[model samples]
Target: MRLAFSLFVAGFVTLAAPVAAQSPDPVAPVKEVMDVTVTNWSDSVDEWKGIFEGDRLNRLYTKELVELYKKASEKAAKIFESEEPVDPFDYDVVTNSQDGCPLQDVKIALAGEKDGVSDVAVSFRLWACEDNADTKNLVSEVHFDVVQEDGKAVIRDIHHVADGERDSVIEELKAIIAQEE
Candidate 1:
């Protein structure tokens, strides 16, 4: 019995060792996507400094987010034209603060993802050239929610961090859209 048990344990380890060695890191693909998006976006933002604030702000978000904002902006414009009582959407949702914005003086770090109950949180970081009242040089850890959309991985929401507080881009969009009626 002892001999039989010892052989089974040895065989299990042998099989498991090779499988573990061959398996690629599950988080590697997530990191790659985050790196490309975050790094490229940072480069673009820095390159376009001193341009119109609107243009700069538009450049910092994903295409889906940009489109969503554009729609809301159109609605808000109509409201303003008609002299509405309340603003349809808070424009600060993207930047996470009323007046503050994201400035990427350096490339953002693409950290690994944390598995959540409903979605995955891909970690990232941004930095400033100098620390100020709003941001540290290293800023803080930011998280983007990755969801499988149409069989491909796309960021559905951003947990935006500005002025040291976290906010959600998708939640803000929902709130703005809900106010339409």
Candidate 2:
């Protein structure tokens, strides 16, 4: 009985070792952001506010991106205090639009790694909650640059394409900050 129990324990340890030693998925942060975006599509104000102001900002985004976002937010706040208040980001940065529907056929994959950063490709079709919505015009794609930070994967930048126009979140944020200054 003692020998049998010892063998069982050893087998359990061996089986668990591989699972415990697996590396973190580089695409996890991208998937998480997409999931949150889709799930909170109806509550854009609070959801985005939480992502920008709460701990999720630091947990999911790189330091440089976070700094840029903070600067933009500060500038927006200052403008809000002025006589003519204007929203710096009129559209949702993630979707690159002011309107979005529930996501369907969502796909997230780690495309490749370059210079220690991983490229994550995300594509989805907008489900308008209709039985016969045109799916062709509702497709969207975004790419995320992720890097290891503190031994965890975090998003460094986001690239969005819409209507044959290319946009980078980092570049947009910098442009917004520069335009105001």
Every model: Cα RMSD to truth: 9.9, 4.3
lDDT of each: 0.47, 0.77
Poorly placed runs, candidate 1 (over 4 Å): 1-74, 80-127, 131-138, 161-166
Model 2: how far residue 76 lies from native, Å: 1.2
Residue-level lDDT of model 1, residues 4-121, one tens digit each, is 9999999998977755323333333335544444433453444422211355334433457656655655566675675433334443322333332334432233345555212334
Predict model 2's lDDT versus the native: 0.77
Q: Once model 2 is optimally superposed onto the true structure by TM-score, how far is the C-alpha of residue 71 displaced, in angstroms?
A: 0.6
For candidate 1, what is the TM-score?
0.41
RMSD of candidate 2 to the truth, in angstroms, is 4.3
Local error of candidate 2 at residue 127 (angstroms): 5.5
What TM-score does model 2 achieve against the real structure? 0.75
Residue pair clashes in candidate 2 = none
Per-residue lDDT of 1-181 in model 2, one digit per residue for the tens?
Answer: 9999999999999987766555568888887788777776653446344345467789899999988888777677676775443346777667776666766678899889999989998888765565665754477888899998878889989988778776788887888788654
